[model samples]
Target: MISARNFLHFSRGVALAAAVCFFAATLAVAQTDALPSWNDTAPKQAIISFVEKVTKPDSADFVPEAERIAVFDNDGTLWVEHPIYTQLAFALDRVKSLAPQHPEWKETQPFKAVLEGDMKALAASGEKGLVELIMTTHAGMTTSDFQKIVIDWLASARDPKFKRPYTELVYQPMIELLAYLRANGFKTFIVSGGGVELMRPWAEKVYGIPPEQVVGSSIKTEFRMEDDTPTLFRLPEVNFIDDKAGKPVGINQQIGRRPIAAFGNSDGDLQMLQWTTMAGGPARLGVLIHHTDAAREYAYDRDTEFGRLDKALDAAAITGWTVVDMKADWKQVFKD
Candidate 1:
């Protein structure tokens, strides 16, 4: 009962309306699916369940927005820490770059090992030798200078396996989890064993956690004025070590309030989980990221020297902490 022209226009309008409706539905699904990168497994469900209980008004586990503090370890928990800690890699590169300035490094046990790329010899250097490497490469510069050096190094630095910029190596699932928690009125902080200065420059851009919310191990610094500019000069001395027992102390000193949730991957984070979950004022959550994905990423637990997941892996059974099996729990490791 319509002209050909009228009928054609009407058909076009119908298609347009359908497209709009479809687009809206797709958007809604995306908005609701907070962790698309995560497999719809128990670990994903546990995270969602905890967030719901803590944020829901009628739930007994509901915590006020201010008290909903969540802490995360940076290295293995949030991003890749396999092969070696990213910071150590940076230090090794730095030792090489600075070799021309210090000729004695050619003969030094650790430095010589680093230059020769001898993993066994480097391991033999032990904790003292490792500390010496950290001090030699990390100190004797202003905080601003140190940050700039880190930023420059990160700009070109690529993971040995992925061959992608280190920043691009962050776990997509964890990034989604961070945004999900923040969207739910929970504050997030990165409590890492990595240097505070090293992370503060990039954490906000990389993880959405601002520099002020980053807490980590640090060296002693001296305030001095150079050419009328006030600067904090990093010294070759340890001020704090924010690992194991030190994590809780760092959190207490910096964050003040006890975190309601803690996420970590290694034994270094055991005390942090204990502090968050054991002090029973409210319902708390502890999560450990188990590196089980060998195909998509490196897999190491009991045997690895770096980012070893041993005691905490054992504790998760008794403490009831959610152990996220990376192979089974995460659908995607890195973002597209």
Candidate 2:
């Protein structure tokens, strides 16, 4: 019923509105800081500067999208690894859960230590006992079954100090950093000493990192046919421990290419950082998250049983790696 002139004017008005909305959205995105949780500190500036240099096509240090790889350690770097490692907590809980099936655990050295909540005894069990505990709790199931177990445990597991689910303890700044890197054409990968299967179940949901992008310690998995269906069964055998020196080996085997950026918290990530940043390259970034805030998060370094940061702390200073002081550099630790 409208005249052609009127209809044309109405269409133009709508187009103008759409254009204004689009411009506003673009402006908002451009103005938003990628890492809002991170304070405007030296570490944040360093991260942004490195990413910009590598991503800008006109920059001399520009790295192609295909070569833009960033690796992050999973424990204290991405999430909370305080009081104890998340995996260790899982193992301890698993020991208690399976204790009813194995009565001998009541008298077993490490198992008994775990059952009685004897911290001193558990520590005395050493790496060997820890390995034994991990094998027993993490193996003797199919890969799919193990994944379900991990998923289930993570769903209900709560940090003793924070009383929050373990997954909720992930660092907000790190999460933002991961997304920022990905947004800038970098493929982010989790290279951790935690069990690969254990992390694979929740990595995508929590960190937006896929299962294949995770490189971590793993137990032996054997292929077999179960009732006509092919299955990969986990075995109680140590395959690879992706910590310290093993990190580079795992990266080569899994990702096949070197990462230009690496992030970590503890000494376990020293070799990984060295491999990523020290490799002859255009512009590489290495960041160490120093847990310096005891109020918001647990702070521990050289003296801590888990996530010992001594060697890495010293190396960061010498190697020019940017160390992020959690208390000063991060405005918020965990996402609300």
Candidate 3:
């Protein structure tokens, strides 16, 4: 018969083995889970199917790694864009901070609207007023100085609705999707309508996309030498608008290769989707993220002022694009 001490030693060995097996199993699950934050719904399945179709060398839809480009919209698609855009919030805050220097701003329509926390008045100011605000606050500075200003603002600014830093408000499912694509050898680019310089300041740290790969609206800049140091000075005039139809134009000028996949959330992205999936040789993927979860995240479409999802909503059905119901497809919203 085995001694009691020998039996105890045997039990210890078994327990250690069980612990190691559990750890191995947990690691295996993690490695296999491409989009853990996404529910195992039709949208998730479609994403996996497309990735597999394009990446599989044996498949007819196989696309080379160099041509497997995927473009994503920044504002609503990657992160939160509700109540007001993050950039607009920054502009409003800048107006308030600069109010002491420009006492006349207190009487100015758009600046006054921002100072008094009057969102309705700000909205009434229209595109022209918005442009004025952007130009006044964003221009007349070196590009490097502007980037530093942006980075500093984002560090202190919190989303009013979430009471969290704007960077922390990125969708968990989308983050996972970006990683999954990168792991599969796809080069992802952010073709947002937001300001390119504004995004380049923090996009790499936040989204793993480098500066040169980002494309967006920009203002004119002049090359100059100040204090024997070369600097690019931002001009108040608009150079390019990367929204709606301009998205396609931006893609053509910035990224010469047509993307095999495109992801976006609003009507601003409609032309982008059309440009990406249409006139395609291999199977192209165009997916739209519909904000349908009200309790977890704001739910508004066709009627919302920001990130409006009207025409794109109707086109998804007609064009056979996969429209993700955020409430159903996303298991989690923000990255807790």
Candidate number with the higher lDDT (1 or 2):
1
lDDT per residue, candidate 1, 1-336, as tens digits? 899999999999999999999999999867789898999999998999999999999999999999999999999988889788999999999999999998998898899999999989999989999999999999999998999999999998899999998889899999999999999999999999999998999999999999989999999999999899999999999999999999999999999999999999999999999999998766799999999889999889989888888998899999999999999999999988
| Alpha carbon lDDT at 274, candidate 3 | 94
- Cα displacement (angstroms), candidate 2, residue 113, comes to 1.1
C-alpha lDDT (0 to 100) for residue 268 of candidate 1: 93
Off by over 4 Å in 3: 1-31
- The list of candidate 2 runs beyond 4 A from truth reads 1-26
Report the backbone clash tally of model 3.
Answer: 0
- Give lDDT tens digits, candidate 3, residues 1-336: 879999999999999999999999899867899898999999999999999999999999999899989999999999999988888998998998889999998899999999998888988999999999999999999999999999999999999999999999999999999999999999999999999998998889989999998999999999999889999999999999999999999999999988889999999999999999888578899999999999999898899889999999999999889999999999899877
Q: Which one is best on lDDT?
A: 1
Q: Which ten residues in a row have the lowest lDDT in candidate 2?
A: 276-285
User: How close to the true structure is residue 317 of candidate 2, measured as C-alpha lDDT?
Assistant: 91
Query: Candidate 1 regions off by >4 Å?
Result: 1-31
Error of 2 at 111 (Å): 1.2
Clashing pairs in 1: none
Error of 3 at 163 (Å): 0.6
